[model samples]
Target: MNGAESLVETLVDNGVDICFANPGTSEMHFLAALENPRMRSVLCLFEGVATGAADGWYRMKDKPASTLLHLGPGLANGLANIHNAKRASSGMVNIIGEHSTSHLKYDPPLTSDIEGLARPLSHWVRRADSSDTIAWDTVQAVEQASQHPGKIATLILPGDTSWREVSAQVELPKRVAAQPKVPKAPDAARIAHIARVLQSGEPTLIILANKATRGLALERAGKIAAATGARLGSQFFTARIERGAGRVPIERIPYAVGQATEFLKGFKHIITVETREPVAFFSYPDKPSLLKAEGTLVHTLVEADEDSALAFEILLDELGAAHAKPVLQQRVEVVVPQGALNPLSIAHALSAAIPENCIVVDESLTTGRESMGHTMGAKPHDLINNLGGSIGYATPVATGAALACPDRRVFCMVGDGSAMYTIQSLWTQARENLNVTTIIFANNSYAILKAEYANMGAGVPGARALSMIDIDRPSIDWQAMAKSMGVPSVSVDTAEAFHKAMADSVRTPGPVLIQVRL
Candidate 1:
């Protein structure tokens, strides 16, 4: 078998069956190997979309998905989403194509440092030296990606390495049962210390992240909060959280520096879980970087690589709070607004229209910031946020999540400016016939930047400064753009229309776009 065939077979034999690919000439052999029925190949127009899709897949599937990128330039094109995925702790195995070894001596145009491009975002990076080693290298990459909380692993394959036939004498490597690197148990002393702190009667806030924000870990945290007076909080931007009616809700720290500082000032102690002490998203003039009040003590209950559920289980034992009734968010009825599509009205409409078991990918930095708070009591759903502060992540991530959970609908909320960054994601969604409802908030500007300008103590923006942030010079025809990509779409101006669109989109099959003109 050719090296590329072995690599594909190995990936399928292991658990990675889906591949997001944007290939070039150097990757043709590997692309051809994708014809293996066991491996499902998805074509992405941009490398960023491929990487972002892999991130989404890992988030929903709780497993690594493979991505095939072209040369160094291709990897670079994908780096932004890779940065987002790394920050989100989503597992992915990236196979980057490289020029053949012989061609490198001639200094070919496409030749560049693939390893250099991958290191900052990747937890593990390797290059296949020969055809016989490709399968082994792929196995190692998958193992790295499968670690607890997930990791990015990049495997570089030279052109010859993929096309060259493996020698018959070299027996093909069999799939080994990879040992999943589970999260280590927290120290008993540390758990006991935290238990004492919780019982101190001081107003404390337990900040959750990573694996601590969902499932049994979250329920245990709620019990701890119920037994003690501690409040549960989360960062402004978290990777993935399971929330909604019937789930334990977490208070999201405000996004703005001033607001966040104000919200956090009341806590006497801050306990961290798989995350750090609260800090401002960015530094501003005369503002403190840490959000906590003066003299507040910070304690670590669970390290990033530690088992949060286990820690909480032991903490429950120490506090005798295992039987404490945990507080759960009750379902609330939201009235859908009629006229005007402001943030509050939009949020209400969303809360009223969200379907059960939907996956919401949020990148509506400005308009939909309130959506989360409003939807807290809506139908049960999973929420994903941009932890890396990157734009254009919502649509592609929604695409991946929909593929991962084909039975569940995905609602992607992104601003017009951010949507343009990876609008190519629409085509892939359409091609895959994914169950994705993409909502584009067409505000005609980088509205968040406009807010940041004032937050930075810059006076009112001048005409020139406003021009830089505004995209109103020629308004984008979002409907036409959606049509070009073969996805059915609708335009909404009123809250009622938006609410109706959201409710109706899920009923129809395949991908649909809703352009909310604000």
Candidate 2:
């Protein structure tokens, strides 16, 4: 078998069957090897889409997905989403193609430092030295990616390594059969201390993130809040959160520095679970970077690599709150708005139209600021936010989520500005026929930047400055764009029309786009 074939076989045996690929000449052998029916290869027009899709897949499947990139430049193109995936703690295995060892001596044009490009975003990085070692390297990459909370693993494959023949007599190294690593249980003394703090009757907030924000871990946190008077909260941006009606409600910390500071000022203590103390996304003039109030004691209940569910269980036992019933969010009946399509109306429309058990990938910087709050009492669903503060993550992530959970629909909400960054994602969605409904809030500008300008202590923007934030010079026809990519689409200028579009898109099969004109 060739090195590429061996690598593909290893990936499938390790439970990584899906590959999002954007290949070049260096990956020809690997591309040929992908003909193996056991491995499903998806073509992404851009490397960023591939990486972002892998992130989405990991979030939904709780497993690693592989990505195939051409070279250093290709890996560089995929880095932004890799940054997003890393911040989200999504597991991904990236196979980056490299020029042959012989070609490096000539200093080829495509040659660049692949390792240098991957290190900042990847948890593990390795290069296949020979055909015989490719299988071993592939196994290591998959293992790294499969860790709890997930990790990014980049495996660089040189051209010679991919094409070289391996003798039939050479036996590939077997993966040491073992169970995946479980998160360490929190220290008993630490849980006892936290239990005491919770019972002190002091106002406290338990901040949740990562695995702690969902499932039984969330339930345990809710019980703690019920037994004590402490509130349950989450960071402004989280990787994946299971929320809405019938689920235990957790307060979302405000995103703006002033608003967050105001919201947090009432707390006397902040207990963290699998996340750190709250902090502002960016520093502004005359503003504190840390969001917690002065003199507030911060305690860590669960470390990132520690088991949050176990810690909560221990805390529950210590507090005698094991039988406490957590409060759940009740369903709210939202009436669909009619005329204007402002933020409030838009939020109401979404709250009314969203289906149950769907996935919501949110990157609507301007319009979706209030979406989470409005949708809190809607149907139960999984919500994914961009933790890395990167734009253009929603559509691609939605694409991946749909692939991972074929039975569920995916709603992608993104602004027009952010949508343009990875608009190529729509084509992949269409090609895959993924069940994704992409909503574009077409304000035709980087509206968030305009808000940030004032937030940063800058005065009102002049005409020239406004020009940089506006994109209305020639308004983009989103319907035409979607149709060109083989995805059906519609345009709406009113809340009612947009709501109808959302409801209708869910019933329709395959990918669809809704352009909400502001």
Candidate 3:
């Protein structure tokens, strides 16, 4: 058996059934081994799409998928999304192919520092030293990626390793049945300390993130808030948050420093669970880096690696609030607004049309910032924010999410500029016949950059400066773009038109793109 075959077998044995790949020459053997019907190989035109799709797959499937990237340059192209995946705590196995060891001394044009590029984004990085060890390395990579909150495990494979003959595949130890680690219970002293702070009834706020923002943990958090009169909030940008009608809603700390500061203004204590204390996304001139008001104390009930759900349950028990019914958001009627489409009208249209059990991938930049509040009580859905602050994620993530959960509708909201970066995802969505509704906010400019320039205290931009952000030199025909990619699409300018387009897109099957022109 060759190393490539054994590597593929190892991954499949470990439950990694899918691979997103943008392969090249060095990966030829690995690519050939993919002929095995057991492993599904998805061809991504760009490395970023491969990585971003893996991120989406992890979020929806709760397991890591493998990605095959070309050498250093290819890994470099995919780094931004890898960075985003790391921040989201999404698990992925990145298989980067390198030149044969002998060729390295000759300094091939493609040769570069692959490990250096990978280390920044991956929690674990290892290179297969020889063909005999490839399968063993593959097994280790899967284990690293399967941890509770998920992680990125990168394995660098030299070309010679894949081509060489191995006597036999590594005989990995018999797998142990994985039991969800029983979270180490918090001591009575710590629980009492948190309980005391919450019961003090003096403006305590609980910040939730990661696992704490979804499922039963969120419910217990709501109960704690209900019993102690403490408030609940989350970071402005989070990986995935379960929120909608009948669910306990959390006040997300605003993206703007001033607004976030005001949100946490009077709180005397901020309790953190699987999330850090509130901090601004960027340091504004003369603005405090910390979002909370001065003199506010930050306490941690559970750290990033701790089990957030159990921690909150313990806190609820300590407060005698286990049975307290929490306040939940009532269903809000979705209404189609009249007149021209603006941010507010756009939000209203989405609030009305997003389907129940839907997944919303947001990269709408400035336009969709305020839209979350409007969708609070529409229907139960999962909202995925760009925790890594990287652009071009919405479309690919939507593609992967739809593939992961075929029953749920996937809605991708992206701004014009960001949409262009990964527009190829639309073709994949169409080819796979996935259920995806892509809404491209065609404001025809980098709206967030313009806002940032102003926020940075820079004076009004000149014609040249404005030209850099404005995308309207020759307005992009998004309808044509989608149609060219084999997806049905339409352009809409008014709120009613957008609402109709969205509703139609969701009701119908396959991929559809709605270009909302403001």
Candidate 4:
């Protein structure tokens, strides 16, 4: 068997059966090996599509899917979404192609360091030294990716190694289970310290993220808050948060450092579970990086890899506060709003119209943050975000999420600017007939960037700078574009119109786009 064949067999043996791919010359052999009926290969028009789809698949399936990229440039094209996947804690195996070892000595143009590019975002990176080692390397990659909380694993395969013949006698490595992260028990001294701080009559806040954002961890934290009057909050961005109707709701820390500092200033104690104290996403010229108030004490209740639920349970036991009922939000029936077109009205309409058993792919940036919180009480649904802070991921991720969970409807929310980044995702959605409702907030500009410019302390710009922020010189016709890509679509300008269109699309089934002109 050749190296490519052995690699495929090894991956299938390890339970990685799906591959999202946009291949080039170096990957031709691996592509051919995909003919094996055990492995399914999905062709994507762009590398970003491939990576985003893998991300969506992991979100639903909780299993790693593989992506086959060309050379360094192709991998670079997919890096943004891969970064997103990593942030989401979505596991994925990236099989990147490289020049043959023999050709590498001459330092060809495509010979950029794949390992260097991948290290920042990936938890595990490897390059197969020869055809004989491909099987073992592939197995390790799968193992790393399948770790708890998920991880990104990149395995580089050179062309010569892929096509080279390997001995059939070479045995595939045994697959090992990923190690589980065990939560450290709080010591008696630490527990007493926290207890004293809580009883000191000073304001305190408990911040949650990762496992603490959902299920028992959140419930326990709520109980602790109720018992001690501590404020409960989360980081501005999270991997996955189990929120919405009937679930415990925790407030998110404001994004701006000034606002976060102001919000947290009164607290004398800041306890963190599975996360750290609030910090600015970016460093500003005159702002402090940490958002905690001056003289506030920071305490670590649980580490990121630890089991937050268990830690909270222990804390509650030590405090003699178990059996305290956590506050839960009552689920509300959907009520469609009637008003002019605006961000608030759009959120209300969405809360009323999002169907039951649906998945929300949110990339609406500034517009959808409040909207998402409003919809939490409306229905039980899954919410996916661009965890990597990258734009242009929602559309393709929605497509993959739909494919992963065919029974659930997918409602993708994206801005006009971000949608154009990977609009090709619509074609794939249409071809698959996946039930997806795409809402494009057509403000016709890079709205998020505008906010960033101000946050970064940039002065109000002249016409030329403003022009770079604007995209309306030739406004895109989303309805026409959706139709051209074989997906039915409509344009709406009022809340009433958007509500009607969204309701109709959900009821009828199949893929449809609703362009909200703002």
Candidate 5:
């Protein structure tokens, strides 16, 4: 068998069944090997879409999905989304093909420092120098990606290495075979210390992230909160937060620095689970870098790489709160919103329409702030936010989420400006006939930038600056845009109309779009 075949087989053996690809000539051998039915290959129009889709797959499946890219330029094209995936702690295995080793001295047009391009975004990076080692390398990459909290692994394959014949595949060593699959439990001493702090009569807050924000882990955290009267909250941008009615609701810390500072004022001790001390996304002039109040003591019960769920379980037992009934959000009455389209009305409309078992991919930026709080009581659903602060992730991510959980509907929300970046996702969604309803907040401008301009302490945007932010001179017709991509769509100018469009799309099969003009 050829190296490409060996690599594919190894990936299959490791249980990575999907490959999101945007292959070029250098990757033909890998492409040819894709005919093996063990692995399903998906074609993405853009490399960013492939990487973003892989991110979404991992968030749903808790496993790595492989991405096939052409070369350095192809890797570069996908880096933005890879950055997003890395920040989100989503597992991914990227196979970035390179030119033949012999062709490197000639400085070919496609040749570049692929490692340099991948290092910034990848947790593990390796190159398959020979056909004999390619399969071993593939398995290593898969293992790295499957670790708790997940990771990004990039394996660079030269064309010659992929096409070369291999007598036999490389096997993992005995030591590698014995490596533990389970994450190590948190330190007993540390958990005890944090428990002591929680027992103090001072006001405290428990901040959750990663696995601690969802599932039984979150329930245990809620029990701890109930027992100690400690507040529970999460960072503004967690990867995947389990929210909605019936789930224990953890308040998301506000994004605005001043607002977050005020929100954190009452807390004396802040214990973080699977997250770092809260910090501002950007360093604004004169603003403190940390979000917690200056005197608040921040501590860690679980580090990011540790098993937060297990840690929380231990803590629950230690605090004698194991059987404590946790507080849950009550289902709110969904009153169909009426009147003009604004953030609150849009929020109310969505609170009324979002279905149970939905996967919501949010890249709505400034426009989504109002809607996020309302959705907590809508239904039991998964909410994915942009942890890397990257735009264009929602559409592509929604497409993959739908693919991962075919029985559940996927909802993608993005500002019109961000949607334009990976809009090709709609075409793939239509072609696959996936159940995804993409909502475009058609504000006709880069609304996030307008808010950032003020936050950055810029005096105010002049006509030229406003011109750069505005897309209104020739506003995009989203309905036409989506239809051109084979997605049925509607343009709504008011809350009532948007409510009907959202509700109707949920019942329809396959992909659809709703443009909510602001």
Candidate 6:
């Protein structure tokens, strides 16, 4: 068998069955091998779509998916989203095709350094030197990606290596088990110190992230808060947060430095679980990067990658707070809202319409910050964030999430500008008949960048600069776009209309798009 065939067999053996691919000349051999029924190849219009879809698949399935990119430029085009996938701890094996060794010596234009571009975002990187080693190399890449918390593994395949015949039979390597996490116990003295602070009646806050955002860690944090009267909060943006109806909700620190500082001002002590003291997402000219209130004492109960849930459990036990009941759990029954639509009204409508056991993929950057708090009491659901802060992630991620959990509804909330980044994802959703309700916040501008410009100390711009921030010279008609992509759609300007549209979309089976006119 050729190297491409062996590589495919190895990935399938390691349980990576889905491949999101955007191929070119260099990848033809590997693409041909994809005829094997065991592997499912998804054609993506853009390299970014391929990478973003793989990311979404990992978020829902907790398993790595592969992406087949043509060459250096293809990998480069996909790098932004791959950076995001890496930050999210979403495992993925990127199979990057390269020119033959003989061709490389001539230094062709496409022969740019692929490894240099991939290293920053990848945890594991290797180039197959020969056809005989491809199988073993692929096995290692899969194992690395499948590691606990997930990782990015890039395997560069030279053209000659993929097409050449191996004299000896290739063998796949045995997969290694993920290493167990060992959480550090909070020191007794530190626990006693925090207890004294809580008893002292000084205002305090307990921040959470990672594993602390869900299940036992959240429950334990609630118990501690109930017993100690300390405020519960989380970082402004988390990797993966488990929240919504029936879950104990923690307040998120605001993204703006001034707002976060004001919010944190009352706390004299700030305790953390699986994260550090809160900080601004970006630095303003005169504003402090750290968002802690002046004089607030910061303490760490657990570090990220440590077993935060276990650490919280131990801390609760240490505080003699075990068995303390959580803050009362309540579920909000869906109630369709009325009135004209805006950000607030749209949030209200969403709170009333979100379905139970749903997965909400949020890339509606500027318009969706309030969504977390507003939808906190809605039906139980999983919330996935754009951990890599890249635009055009939500739609594709929603596609993969729907595929992974066919029983659950996937709600993709994206800003109009961000939606355009990977709008082609709509076609994939329609083709698969994925249960995705894509809500596009049609503000027609890069609204988040506008906010960032002021935050970055740039003086309010003249008409020319402002024009660059705006996208409305010719606004896109999302309904037409969705229809063209084979997904049904509706445009709404009022809360009632949006709610009805969301309800109708969810009640029916296939993909639907709701354009919320701003």
Clashes of each: 0, 0, 0, 0, 0, 0
Pairs with backbone N, CA or C atoms under 3 Å apart (clashes), candidate 1: none
lDDT of 2 by residue, 1-518 (tens): 99999999889888899999999999999999999998989999999999999999999988899999999999999999999999998999999999999999999999999999999899999999999889989999998998887899999999999999977887775543124668887999998999889989999999999999889999988888888989999999999999999998989999999899999999999999888899999999999999999999999999888999999998999988899999999999999999999999999999999899989999997899988899999999999999998787888889889999988989999999999999999999999999999999999899999999999999899999999999999989999999999999999999999999999999998999999999
Worst 10 residues of 3 by lDDT: 172-181
Cα displacement (angstroms), candidate 1, residue 253, comes to: 0.4
Collision count of model 4: 0
Extract clashing residue pairs from model 4: none
Task: Give the root-mean-square deviation of each candidate in angstroms.
Answer: 1.0, 1.1, 1.6, 2.6, 1.8, 2.6
Error of 2 at 372 (Å): 1.0
lDDT of 6 at 135: 83
If scored against the real structure, what TM-score would every candidate get?
Answer: 0.99, 0.98, 0.97, 0.91, 0.97, 0.92
Using TM-score as the measure, name the better of candidate 1 and candidate 5: 1
Model 4, range 206-310, lDDT digits (tens) per residue?
888765776677888888888788888877777656667777777777777778888889889998876677878889899999998889999877765567777
Lowest lDDT 10-residue stretch of candidate 2: 172-181
Model 5: what TM-score?
0.97
Residues 207-232, model 5: lDDT tens digits: 99888888878888888888888989
lDDT of 1 by residue, 25-140 (tens): 99999999999998999999999999999999998988999999999999999999999999998999999999999999999998898999899899999999999888888888
User: Local error of candidate 4 at 172, Å?
Assistant: 1.5
Task: Tell me the spans in candidate 3 whose CA falls farther than 4 Å from its real position.
Answer: 169-188
Name the TM-score of candidate 3. 0.97
